[model samples]
Target chain A: MDVILLQLLNGLDKGSAYALIALGLTLIFGTLGVVNFAHGALFMLGAFCAVTVQRLLSISFETIDPDKVDFLGNPAKVKTPYVESWFGPEMGGAIVDWSVPIAILFAIPIMIAIGFIMERGLIKHFYKRPHADQILVTFGLAIVIQEVIKQFYGANPIPTPAPDAFKGSFDFGVLLGFDPNAVIYPYWRLVYFGFAAIVIAAVFAFLQFTTFGMVVRAGMADRETVGLLGINIDKRFTIMFGIAAAVAGLAGVMYAPINSPNYHMGMDFLVLSFVVVVVGGMGSLPGAVLAGFMLGILESFSSMNVIKSIVPGIDQIIIYLVAIIILLVRPRGLMGRKGVMED
Target chain B: MLGLEKKDTSLLIIVAILTMFAPFILNPFPEGSALAQFNAGYPDLMQRFVIFGIFAIGFNILFGLTGYLSFGHAAFLGIGSYSAVWMFKLLGYNIIPGIVLSVITSGLFALLIGYISLRRSGIYFSILTLAFAQMSFALAYSVLTPLTNGETGLQVYNSDPQYFHSENMPNIPHLFGAKMQGTYSLEMGPWSFDFNTGYYLCAIIMLGMFYLAIRIFRSPFGLMLKAIKTNQTRMNYTGLNPRPYTLAAFVISGMYAGLAGGLMASMDPLAGAERMQWTASGEVVLMTILGGAGTLIGPVLGAGFIKYFENIFSKINDTVLHQWFAFLPDGMENFVITIIHPFVGKGWHLTLGLLFMAVVIFLPGGLVEGGQRITAALRRRAGRSGRSGDDASSTDTTPAE
Candidate 1:
């Protein structure tokens, strides 16, 4: 029971990430009818935003310290960050420690702006083209974005540590009435899950309760009818694109400490998130989230020794196998509507 | 000529002339010169040009004709490589058996994948193929390590059985007695050219495949595939089943990829799982699109263009950049090198990405269309000038078509 619970906890963080990215993909598919292959690059850019924030906060200037002597017998030099000098050491130190969270504030606007530019500049032109062309153009954009990031950050993964306060692991087993050390979950992972839940909820609420979202939903169902009603559905759809980008960006910002931010991390997540979206039924928001978490748990479960013993190397290919079987059996996916991409 | 149309015969002859004289044509730069770094006539790179040309041609047969974009084609290439290497281990280093086995195996594998993947179309088909490819990659990388050799990659060891081995037979891959690596270099006053046995073998095979592709393009079967691309629903309404035609194209292309992979292994006797990665599959798609998909000569041209640029662009570094800009003032040279630094060497992919986007957006028909447009414009100019003279009749007889 403890092992099962532990694996479930383990699955949540990764599942949250998949759900977040798939949600964004489905949103763009639903609204703009564009398959944005570069969506993963957006997730990657969000992580880099955190890296950028940390680097910015840590920019230091050197000053001579007369009281201390160096190893060379000269006066020691102290390097103090601009943040430390401006806000005083304690507050500035706290701010730097919390850079990953601080990045969310910066990433939202930046990611939305990027989404706007991408839609207006590149994706906007591909609306009337074939799906293959849309995929090809966006794929090119993904490669360009990934390469540009690699050029700036080099090819190595950069570790972005979480704030000091959330550094330690929590004893979940004791709370669940199991052995003390059976289910030791990290504090940050719990925080990530909560953050993901809030974001997912907020997006749902925005789409459900707001008049703008209602218009966007109407546009998704029938763009011509919405346009015929004299609603500026295209403009609203673009805003929806921006919101989706922010959601994906937020997912990446929170995920930085879990996995080191790397240039190719986006591509890695991209293939899996795509499978998640397809399995959940394309253009279905609730289906994407549910499928993401389910696949994440299944992936973790398959990686267990018990499962591996039954089917050797099952862990590496379980998701793909499931995806294939699901695709073959349920062509439209779990919640797919009839005639949605049926052609 | 050779059962080909007049235009196709000329195109075939042109391709033949180019491949046959490649060593001379590609090595235009003199040996040990400042521009020598740009030459791509070496045995290894030449072998790749033809091998990839075959791969792209096969891909075009499926994607260009049927408009079914598959993202799992690299899995066939990887399977071909692994089977070829296995053949080398079980039998002798003779490439004939390895190449044959590779085609059969990859064809069977493609039949299986295509049967399932062809059930859907558009993005769903792409994602399905992508999933299968990734699954194959994962399995090859780990679960099937005994067969694939995992991270170390599959290579023939001394202990492996080679039933056809003999003292007189070359240990490395060979055709009868001719070693694949054997090269004859000709050195002139300032020019040098390398004629490699492996390159010639690959070039001949590529030409055979190219001819076959041309035949396929002109056949009634080819028209059906093109019809499927145009409108499958209408074809279905016309009482034609598109499934069998698409599957055949998919399998044939898979065999082409396998042949290329087999040739690759024959040249260098090693098979790695990385060859099956989706990025490698993406490379073939890029080649077809860049050259102009559906055009007869486009895939070969695109393949050669990409491979040649990849070789040349990656070789350039800061020192080479500075040397080229030496005539400029020191500060200006430094500035130029810094500006050009990101688009060369390690940054070659960035340039490739931007180029791909520009091609997709501005020139959807690819380089072939661009060439045709330029020729048409030149003809128009000549026609305009000739209209003022007595030669106007000759100009009017030959329209731009």
Candidate 2:
């Protein structure tokens, strides 16, 4: 029971990331009918946005402290952040500590602007192009974006610590009446899981309740009919694109604290998210989310030492193995709508 | 002469002539000159140009003809390399058996993968292939270490069982007795040319493969594959099974990739898991698309261009850039160098990405189409009165659409 619960929690973190990215991929595919290979770059950009904010917040000036002697036997130089000088040391220090969370607000507009520009500028020209062209162009864009980030940040992963409050692990096994140290998990992972749940719910709710989302949903179902209804479905779809980008951005922003932000991290996730999207069935939002979690749980379970000992490398290929089986047995995928990319 | 049509025969002759004298053509600059860095006539790079040409040519047979954009063709290349290296380790250093086994094994692998992956069409097919390739890569990188030798990569070691080992033979991969890396540098007054046995051998194979690709493009099976690409439903209604045709194309391309990979190992005996990664797969796709997918000569041209750019452009550093622009004023030169520095040397990938995007966006039919457009426009300007001439026969030799 402890092992299962532990794996489940572990699964949720990976599932959240997969679901979030796949959700955005499905959104773009469903609405604008573009297969966005560069969506991952947007996620990377969002993480970098957090990095940028942290850097911006902590921009500091050096001054010599006469009280502290340096290693060279001179007065020590003390660096004070500009935020500390501006907002007073305590408040500014607190803000710096919580920059990763605060970056959510900063990334939203930037991501939305990026999405709008991407849709309006490059992707708009590729709307009538072949799927191959769309894929190639976006892949090229992704490479360019990652390369730019690599140039600025270097190739090393940048550590972005979570808030001090969420630094420690929670003993779930003890909470559930098992041994104390049986199934301890980091607090931030739980926070990430909760955050993903809320984001997924908000997106679902917006689509369910709002007229704009209804039109967007209709557009996904039958684009011609929605367009013939004298509705400007394109504008709504563009806004949906922005929303999708924002969702992916927010996911990356939070994930920065979990895994250190690296230029290639988005690419590493993108491939798996693509697998999740395919296994969930293309353009199926709920299917994507469902498969994301299912695959995540499956992946987590397979990675167990017992399973590894049995299969001797099953963990490395379990997701793909499962994907192949599912795709062969049920071509449309679990929870997939009829005739959505069936051809 | 080789069972080719008149136009194809001429193309074959032209390509043959070009490959035969590549050392001369590629090495335009004099020895020890500043522009010598731009020369790509070296054996290693020349081998790559033709080897990748073969790979791209094979990829084009499927993607260009059948319109099935495979995102995992590099797995076959990796498989081929592994098999070839194993042959070298198990058998003697002779390349014929290694190359033959590589093609056969990769063909079988392709047959199995294609059988399953072809169950779906379009993006699903691409995803399925991608999944299989990624699985292979992951397995090779971690679990399959015994067979693959894992992170250190499979290489010819001193302790490997060499039942056919002889004191007189070279340790590196060889053909019968001739060393693959043997090069004879001819120093002509100003220009120097390196004639490598390995490059010539690869060149011959590439020409043979190119000839085979030409024949396949003109064959009835090729037309059938193109027909499927045009409308699979229509072909099915006409009582044609597109499955066998696509599978055959897939297998053939896989073998081509295998042959390329074998040749790669023949030149330098090492096979890494990175060869099977999706990025490598993307490269062949880029090569095919950049050259003009369906055209007989396009893939080769694309392969050469990309390989050349990777080799030559990457060699240009800020120091070199500064030297080139030293004729300008100090401030202006420094400004220009700084701006230009990022897109060259280690930043060549950035330039490549930008160039790839521009090509996909602006020239969808690739460099061939771009060349055709220019020639057509020039002809129109010269004649001024001809109704865009039925020269479509010349330009549309192999239709990409």
Candidate 3:
């Protein structure tokens, strides 16, 4: 029971990221009628934005120690990082620590702009094209974005540490009157899970409570009729696209500390997310969130050693396997409406 | 004049002669010509061009004709490769049996995959095929490592010991005393012609495939497939069951992929799970589209073009750039070289992506359409007599890939 509980906690954290990204994907697909294959790349870009912010915060002028003497040496030694002096050694160090959390603010506007540019510049022209063409072109765009990132950042994975405050694990079992190690979980991952819940709630509240959100939801259901009523359905759809991109970007920003950011990370998540979207029922937001978390937890549980001893490589492909089964059993997916992606 | 409707029997003779003497025509540049970056003369890449051309041409038979986009076509190619390589390991390098086993094996694999996947049409069919392909990829990567040889891929060794015809064999069997890559060349001032025997073998296969494709394109079955493409429901409502016809078309295309895969193995004798990946599957689709899907010759052209670009693009270096910009200012030239540097080597993907995007955006019908547009424009400028003179032949000039 303890092991299961621990796995469930771990699973929810990872599941939160997957759910957030997939929710954004389903939202975009519902409103735009275009499969955004580059959503994964956008997530990756959001993570990179966190990394960039971290670097910027850490940047400082190097000081030359003129008093120290080394024969024929330039200024004896070059003292690096005036950060120690700018905000004092301790505070300067800690002040620059909130890289990922700070990145949320930076990423939103950037991601929104990127989303708009992507729609207005490239994908807008392809709305009338076949799915194959859309897939190919967006796939090309994904490659271009990934390669550009790789060229700048190299192909290696960059580790983004959470703030010092959330570095340690919390023992939940002891608090609940169980043994100490029974339900220990990382504070940051738990924090991430909570953050995801808040964001998910915020999004739902906005959509269910606000006029803009209502208009978007209305547009998603029947854009043709909305357009007939003299509303610019295209404008709403474009804003919805921007919102979806920002959501995925925010997920990536928080996820930077959870998973080390890498260039090809986007491609890795792409196929799986598509499977998630399909499994949840295409264009279904709540279904995407539910299915994403369910599959993530299932995948985590499947990877347990005891489970692996039987299926051998079940962990590597459980999501896809489950996706296939669900798609077969329910052709419309868990909550798919009629005639979505039917053709 | 090569009339559009004429049954040109000489086309066969020409193809045969060309295949027989491909090496002599292909290998003239002595390894340093401007076009030296491109020597279809190399047996491995050349065999790839023709064989994959055959594969894409076969794919065109289904997708181009029936308008059914089966995303899992690479499964057949993978099966074909696996079977051929297994034959080489179990039997001998006698590619005849290898080719035969691969065709049958891939045909069966296709039969199963197609049968299950074809139950759903449109995007559902595509997703089913994708699921099957991913399943195959995963299985090959992990579960079926015994057969697939896992990540390192299937390879041959010297001590594998030929089970048959071992007496006079030197390593693998060769055709008529000619090794696979044995190049023969002749040179002039700025041009050259060279050839290899294995190229002739591949050319023979390519011509056979092209001819077969043309025949299929003209046949009644082909007409039926096209009808299914235009309206399958109409055909079904009219009392014609489309399943067997589509199944047969699927199997035929799968066999073509198998043949291509077999030829690929025979060229270099290795089969890896990478060939079964979705990306590899996408490449064939891209080739078909780039060359003009449904056109017999277009897919072949696209395959050749992409293969050629892939090989040439990777060879470009800073020295090549400096050579191009030798007359510019040192600082300006250095800047230019640095700017252009990312496009070569590891950055070949950038160039490819740009080119792919451009083609997708503007040339939906592919290069064949571009040719048509140019011809139409030329005819418009050529006065009143240009209408029937060239349009008929121009329109029908698909290479029958």
Candidate 4:
């Protein structure tokens, strides 16, 4: 049915975001053994990176045009973006139009640097503390980060529109022999899903093929043994933390157009992403991705009219209900190893 | 006195005196003075101080004693508020019935949630509780709109069934005929003090709850709870099931949260779903930790400290900052204001977050421990100067685990 297909498409963008955030959370938890409650703040910072890029590109200076007259019969003051003047109107306009993509490049290093500072400055000291303390400290950091963002951007959601090319929806229903409007999907959302798939694949490949990844995986399994083997496993773990931060940041950057970048968007996704990580089995990468998509689809399905009619307001609480049921039924999560935070 | 230990009795008396003379103690600054902005002796804020103190004390009973960090306690508080408002709608504006119903309903809700959530410990327990709370919040915000009144919140209306209503009864929430909002202000010279009936009622309740907390801390059951915190595995091996003890603590804390919520509704006569948000739950946790979790007087102190700062800090703005720094040179004043601007008013949460992190990192034992450390250092100096350090070392008190 077109409805089912449409729902699946509806779920993918959100699912990709959940997968991306949960993957990062699991990475930090796996390598550093720190529950970074501020992980959502990182995702938020990534979206802000796109906002920053767009703002930077559109920096304009006003000039009086002698040929044009204003309504008051004075020479018109025309504003031209610095980028337009520097690169010529056509090229500069295109660059500005694609600021969201341009932000991906800018966000990577910035996010990684942030990750490094966060680990080295703050989270490094909390390694031997209780999990509760880690959570508390990170939670404090999240609040601080959120407040800082709110201070800068104000509390309102800033719309970060995608490129002009990706503005409209693609009629998937027509391609699949259904009516034109039946399976309509946004172009940017499809791009987001494809982008997520590539990133997930690249991360998997890097882990599977690289020696550094092997060492990190070994360290994850047994830190002491890796340390005993003369490997600087701690340093590798830190880099992995940066990578995880980059992944989450990229997710945020791409997600800017789908939903306006709000200061609290990170927190809104955070609770659910955490649920995703737990349901996927903590420290399990594949499990995080699978659970992310599963929950996302389930969420969309619950929001369907038929489902809502049967269970009123099911959409509001379906994710949490599923998380609760999953947590209760499968205590260790889907792919969690025995004795991994079992106590 | 009152079946309390000597130290606890003194602490209780001190708290009683402080509450009794709060209008004076809290309003040390005279009316219309530069420091008047810092005064928190108003009925609304003073009421909040005791109400939140009760919530934190209850939280401490669970988290401080058992080391089980719950992140869903606000759900109980919200439930209490809703139940209390319902009582006001059904019965008259009497707070007694509302308060009772709130505690009962929240207790039952906590029992159900605790029974399910207590199956796991550590982060899982926290997440489970959080999920349940979020579910409650979502339900209350939407489908349960009829019960919760949705976004408009639950408030008493003229058309509401008030079977016990009388023509002579006060319209506002009251105890018999004593209005909760009734405040008697006394102005003398430059200073003014307000004696609020609602504040006194809340203060009395907070003191009673504080006393109960102290008793719980000192009881055999308290020791058992601490033991569970220490090592549940060892307790299990010793033939003791920690589940029942933990569930009881959870229920008790939930009831405390509910009582606070009920009190809140009784004072304001409205209940909203935002009260159930996780941030509200986190506020209680922050209060307990910032005060010194597990310490008898810490939660109350923490509650007061946070509430006082939140009120004072939020009231400050750019104009207030300029007034304070007007004596400085123009450039210097501007610089100072710029530096201080981000940590006040709308930026209060930033300061709170930074302070919370610092407390967690540098003073895990919280403000109580910090105070104790300072006193010990001062006594050491005094002893060294007076008695050649003979009793200085012996006077050093180790923090309670």
Candidate 5:
């Protein structure tokens, strides 16, 4: 029972990222009909925002202090860093320490600007082109984005840790009347899960409750009809594109501790997210979140000792196997509407 | 438009003959001259020309005729390469048996992949094929280390269990005049030529494949594939099954990829998992598009252009740039080098991306369309001076596509 709860906790954090990414992907696919192969790159860019901000605040220049002391017949020089002088000690250290949370403000405008430029520059021309053309162009865009990142950051993964405040794990098992260490869960992971749930809820609430969300949803249902009604549906879709980019970006920012930021991290998310979207049924937002978490849990459970003993490589491909089965069994997916990707 | 007649056909034949003798037509560069770097008449680049030509041609057959954009075709090519390398390791280094084995291996693998993937169509089909290729890549990277040699890649080394022993087997195979960079140089003052047998062998094989592709394009099956591409649902409604035709196209293209792969290993026996990767697969698609998808000759031209650019771009350094800008002041020369540095070598990809965007945006029909537009513009200026052999471009990149 304790093991089950611990694994469940583990699954929720991973599932949060998948749900967030998949939700953003479905939003773009549903509204724009572009598939947006570069969404994963957007996600990658989100994490890099954190890396950039961290580098900005934490990067320091070493300087020799004017005062010197001699000890044991050797001249000793005091060492200092320029950041202390620039940001004034405590505040600078705090800014550097809290780069992850600070990146949220930095990531929003950066990601929105990126999303707007991408839609305006290349994706606008491909609106009437074949799905293959959309795929080809977007794929090329993904590669270019990744290569640019690689050029800037190099290929290796850059580790980013959660702030020091959330370092320790909570003794949830003991609180639940079980052994102390049996169901140990990290506070940061719990925070991540909570954050993901809040974001997911907020997005759903915004879409389901607000006027803007209603218009976007209506536009998704019928862009032509909405445009005929003189609503500036294209502009709305563009905003939705920005929103989707922010969602993916935030997911990436939050997921930095889960997996270190690398240029090729986007490629890894790409196909898997596609599978998640397909399994949930294309254009279904809720379905994407549900399927994302479901696959994530399945993957986690498959990696367990009991399951691995039964199937040697189940963990490696459980999600894909589930996807193939779901797709084969129900071509429209669990919550897919008719005529979406049916053509 | 050449009246679609015999006189135009003769002109095309003449052009083909000239292209075949391009080595003789090109001005020879002096040995160790700066211009020597630009001379792609060398055996190494020639081998790539034939191999990638075959790869692009095979891809064209699928994407061009069927309009089924497969982004994972390199899996077959990689399989072919692996099989050819195995043949060389197990059998002798003779080209014939290795080529035969490669074709068979690639064919079988393609058939299997095609059979499974062809169950879906459009985006689903693309995704399925990509997934399968990625799976192959992952398997090769991890579990299939014995066969693929894992990250290190497979290569020829030491003694094999040769049935005829080492004494009888000549290390490499040869055919016609050209050899695979086997012989160094036959110099004549400033000019020199090295013959490669493997390249000649590949060239002959390519010629044969080209002939086969032309025949296939003219066949009933080819017409059916074109129909499938235009209206898959309509074809189904007409009681014509599109599966067999699509599967056949897939397999045939797969075999072509395999043949290219076999040639690669033959040139230098090394097979790596990277060959089967998604990016590698995507490169073939790029080659096909850049050349003009459906056209027979376009893929070869595209392949040559890409490979040549890749070679030239990778070779450019700051020093080379400075030499070119020697007339400038030292500061200006350094500035020029800095400006051009990002576009050279691996950075050549930046140039490729820009070119790709330009091509896709302006000329959706690819290079063929660009050529036709150029011809049309010229014809307008010339005031119907000569017969327009430009019908080839229109036939290749039909606006209806």
Candidate 6:
């Protein structure tokens, strides 16, 4: 029972990421009627945005401190961050420690601008083209974006630490009847889960409550009718694209501390995320979220030692395996609508 | 000749001649010259040109004729490579058996995947293939380590028990006693040409395959595949089963990929999980598109172009850039080098992606279309100066596509 609970938590955290990415994918597919292969690259860029803020916060200068002797018997050159100099040490230290969260504020406008440029410049031209063309162009764009990131950041993964407060594990075992450490989980992962839930909720609320989102929703169902109604539906769809980009970006920003930021990290998640979107049912936001969590939990369970002991390397391929079975059994996916790529 | 139309037969003959004399034609730049670096006349690169040509030609059969965009065809290629390597390990150092086994294994794998994946159409089919390929790649990289050798790649070992081999036989991959890597370079004046055994063998197979592709393209099955591409719903209404036709195309393409993969191992004698990755599959798609998907000779041209750029353009560095731009003013040369630096060397992929985007956007029919347009324009200009301006105008309005 404890093992089950622990795996569920693990699944939720991973599922949170999958849900976030799939939500963005579904939004774009729903609105634009095009598949954006560069969505993962946007996630990668968001993580890099966090790295950028961390670097910016920790910009330091070398100062010779006469009080400290060097190994070579000279005055030691001590490096102090500019943040520490501007603010007092404690405040600046805290600011540097919490750069990942602060990156949310930094990543928003940049991601929005990126989203705007991508939509207006490239994707706009491809709106009426075949889906294969859209896929090919976006795939090319993804490669270009990843290569640019690689050129700047190098090929290696850069470690971005979480805040000091969220560093340790949370003992869920003690809260339950189980012994301590039995259901141990990372606190940041919990934070991530809560954060994902909030984002998903906020997106839903905005779509349900806001006038703009309602118009967008109407456009999604019937673009020609919305256009006939004299709403500038194209602009709204463009904004929705930005929102989707922002969602994917935020997912990447929060995910930085879980996995180190790397140029190819987005591509690693890309195929799996597409599976999530497909399994969730194309263009279905709630379906994407539900399927994300389901797949994630199943993946976590498949990776358990006992399960792996039986199948040897089931963990490496469980997600894909599940996807194949699901696709074969339920051709339209869990929540797919009629005539959504059916032909 | 060869059951092809007169025009296609002539095109086949031209291609055969080109491949036969590629060593001489590709080595036009004299050795030790500044432009020599651009030349791709060596056995390794030439082998790649033909092998990848075969792969792309096969891909075009399915994607071009039937409009089935498979993003996981490299799985078949990877399977073929592993099978060929295993054949070399278990049997003697004969490439014939390895090549045959590779085709059969990949054909079987393709049949299974196509049967399931073809149940769905359009994007769903693409995603299904992608998932299956990724699953295969992950398995090959991890659980199938005994078969695939994990990250180190599958290669021949010193202790391999070759049951059919004698004590004095050459251990490297060979055709009877002839080594696949055997090369004879002939120097004529400033121009040197290489005649490699593996390259000629690969070239002959490619010619055969290209001829086969031409025959397939002109056959009744090919027209049916095209009809399916035009409208599967209509085809269904007309009582034609699109499933079997598509499956056959898929399996045939997979076998071609397997043949290419087998040839790859025969030449190099190693197989890695990376060959099965979706990126490799994407490369074949790019080749097919860049050359012209449905047209004969397009895949070959596309494959050759990409392989040439990948091999030759990537070898260039900032130093070479500087040398190339030395005639410019100092600051201008530096600026030019800086601008060109990122799109070459390790940045070749950036250039490739940009070029691919440009092709998809502007030249949807790929290089074949582009070539046709240019020639048509040129012909129109010539006719305008002469007497047949009206005829030229009529031909210009209707694109060959």
Q: Rank the candidates by DockQ, best first.
A: 4, 1, 6, 2, 3, 5
> What is the docking quality class of candidate 5?
acceptable
**Model 5, chain B: what is the TM-score?**
0.90
lDDT of 5 by residue, B146-187 (tens): 888889998877766644335644655422223354755567
* CAPRI level of candidate 1: high
Pairs that clash in candidate 1:
none
TM-score of the first chain alone, every candidate: 0.98, 0.98, 0.94, 0.98, 0.94, 0.98
**Model 2, docking class:** high
Give the per-residue lDDT digits (tens) of candidate 2, residues B219-329: 898889889888899999999889999999999999999999999999999999999999999999999988998898889999999999999888998888988999999
RMSD (Å) per prediction:
2.7, 1.4, 3.5, 1.5, 3.6, 1.9
- Residue-level lDDT tens digits of model 2 in A1-343: 8888888889999899999999999989888878899989988898898899999988999998999998889999999999999999899999999999999999999999999999988998998887878988999999899888988898899998898989999999877899999999999999999999999999999999988778888889999999999998888888888989999999999999999999888888888888898889888999999999999988999888888999988988988888888788988877778877767
Predicted candidate 6 versus true structure: per-residue lDDT over A236-291, tens digit per residue: 99999999999999999999999999999998888889999989888888989999
If scored against the real structure, what TM-score would every candidate get?
Answer: 0.97, 0.98, 0.90, 0.98, 0.91, 0.97
User: Of the candidates shown, which would achieve the greatest DockQ relative to the real structure?
Assistant: 4
What residue runs in model 1 are displaced by over 4 Å at the alpha carbon? A69-73, B387-401
Q: Residue B393: error of model 6 in Å?
A: 12
Q: What would the TM-score be for candidate 4 when compared with the true structure? A: 0.98
Ten-residue region with minimum lDDT total, candidate 5 chain B: B172-181
| Residue B74, model 2: Cα distance from true site in angstroms | 0.7
Please give the C-alpha DockQ score of model 3: 0.50
Compared to the true structure, candidate 2 yields what TM-score?
0.98
Q: Given candidate 4, what's the lDDT at residue B399?
A: 28
Those runs of model 2 whose alpha carbons end farther than 4 Å from true positions after fitting are B385-392, B395-397
DockQ of each: 0.90, 0.81, 0.50, 0.91, 0.41, 0.82
Which pairs of residues clash in candidate 4, taking residues 3 or more apart in a chain or in different chains?
none
Native contacts kept, each candidate? 0.90, 0.71, 0.44, 0.87, 0.10, 0.79
i-RMS, each model, one decimal: 0.6, 0.9, 2.2, 0.6, 2.0, 0.9
